[model samples]
Target: MPRIPLVDVKAQYAPLLPELKQRIAEVLEEGTFVLGPNVAAFEREAADYLGVPETIGVGNGTDAIVLVLNALEIGRGDEVICPAFTFYATAEAIVRTGATPVFADIDAATLNLDPADVAERITPRTKAIMPVHLFGRPAPLAELSKLGLPLIEDAAQAFGSPAVARAGVASTFSFYPTKNLFAIGDGGLVAVTDPELGERVRMLRFHGSRDKVTFEYVGTNSRLDELQAAALRLFLPRLDGWNAARREAVGRYAELGLGELCDLPTDEPGHVYHLCVARSAERDRLRAALTEAGIGSAQYYLPPLHLQPALRYLGYREGDLPETERAAAENFSVPLWAGIGAEQQERVVQVIRAAARVPAAS
Candidate 1:
């Protein structure tokens, strides 16, 4: 058998080719590439899908975060509280905007930002709270709301996850090719409950231009192009089904007792499994075993951002973030892509189970 892939994008694309091809051809005929009708349509559709008032397309997920922060006027001397256990982009966006990134621990079971810890970390400088729907589980939004700060939902991984709830704040999503609701390439969207804030994001995403020649503020170039927008428009309607398939894979992993050896993800009522991850005491050993067995698994993030050498200036120490440190050491992601087959999933579970049973050295 061929080596089990990490994400089977090709498998998913094969079925959608006819429609995808026609859409590309239509864009070519129009020759109106930048932020054209396709982009507007996608924005509308995505907003409706997310059940938000408005959605603004941008260059990518990172820019989506930065643009929203910009619109909120969060800059120098401000502090944005975010979980340290997420992809670096979460805190990186805060740093880029000249704000300080205040690291908070995540909930051990869900791996989402711990709202209680967030409240503990808030200071006079606190400007916003960025809660990531890590591994497709929404953060504790109900608890975070009590803080009364702007909440930026990092919905990059939880695109179609049912855990997405109205946090009465702005949210951002990544449409990178691998995401649940993806485009052909890099793309992003910003969804906001506040209408005025939504309009500001639109301006910030396009060089802060209010009109063609009228620049209202200094902003970066971060507009989503027409080609990617068209592709996403075609793919959006299928998001729920794709997410359901991923959930089924997760169910199979659970039924096989993989959770006993490896810590399988927990399902909340509203969650949509993005990349089903698990915790293992011997993460590296299990990863090597799976690779040798022709099953592809990945370490989502081996080192938490607080411990990264580049961020030493942030004045963090090893013991400063206990939960983040533990998560970094133990977590690894398995293939839960929409089109991953059951046979492939079985092989993957077998390899992981075998690896987990191996004796650890003292």
Candidate 2:
């Protein structure tokens, strides 16, 4: 079999090339390279798609979180509770604001922050709860809301999930090349339910100025540029179709018996399957097997945020978050992308089943 990539980004954009290039050319011709018309149009389109009143385009996903945090006045002495079973940027964003990140364990089934666990981690100084829609699975926002802390969704992987797409006080998205909704390069946005807060985040993404010349608060330069925004505009209308295709691929994984051999991610109506992650006690061995077959695979959050060297000062030990630790030791993502063919999926499943020595489901 030919080498199967974990994400065939080229395949996704191949058919869209003519239009994409035209969009890029328009940006180049206009010479409004930064915070121009395309960015403005994309922000409005994304805001409408997300069903939020406003969306502020920024340079990247990390900046989206930092800008939102700054707008909320959460820093220095406050704490932001989030899961340790996620990417480094989740916690890193909190620490960047001079606030301590209070790491919580994730739900074994969904790999999102366990709200019950979040409640236990909260304190008088806990300013907000940042629940990641990890791997595009919407965290339990309805449950998390009852805890009475502000919810700032780390929605980097969950662009098309409408259920939680507009639920929180604010949600952040990354338009990284591989995301469900993506740009040619880095870009991001913040969706806010409150237009007032949206304006604050908007100003913060620039130099904290409503009109660029009048600086109201000290801020950073993180504006989403015209070129990237133009690419995103081309991709935006097709986002739902691509997400649905990803869901279809995930269903195909189950039909091929991948689910029986490994713990497949729980399928929610909103899950876009950003990556079809599966868990097995023999994960390392399975990853090795996939590699031997020239098939791609990866482990998500191997170190788990709390155990990362940079965050060790938070005093988390090896066994602190049992479920998160176990997940870090076992989760492996199989090859999955929009429009992935059945033959490739079957090849991936065969490799995984062989590596685990598991029989196909009856």
Q: Where's the lowest-lDDT run of ten residues in candidate 2?
A: 353-362
Against the reference, the lDDT scores of all candidates come to: 0.86, 0.91
- Candidate 2 off by > 4 Å: 358-362
lDDT of 1 by residue, 1-362 (tens): 68987888878778999999999999999999889999999889888887888999999999999999999999999999998888889889999999999999988788878888888999999998999988788789888989999888888888876556378478889988878888888998898989899999998887789786998988889999999999998888888888888889999988877887788888877788878888888998999988898777888655788887767899998888888888888888887788788888888888887768743222
| Cα lDDT tens digits for candidate 2, 209-241 | 998689999889999999999999999999899
Candidate 1, superposed: residue stretches over 4 Å from native: 358-362
TM-score of each: 0.97, 0.98
TM-score of 1: 0.97
In TM-score terms, which candidate is top? 2
What is the C-alpha local distance difference test score of candidate 1?
A: 0.86
Residue 292 error, candidate 2, Å: 0.3
Which 10 successive residues of model 1 have the least lDDT summed?
353-362
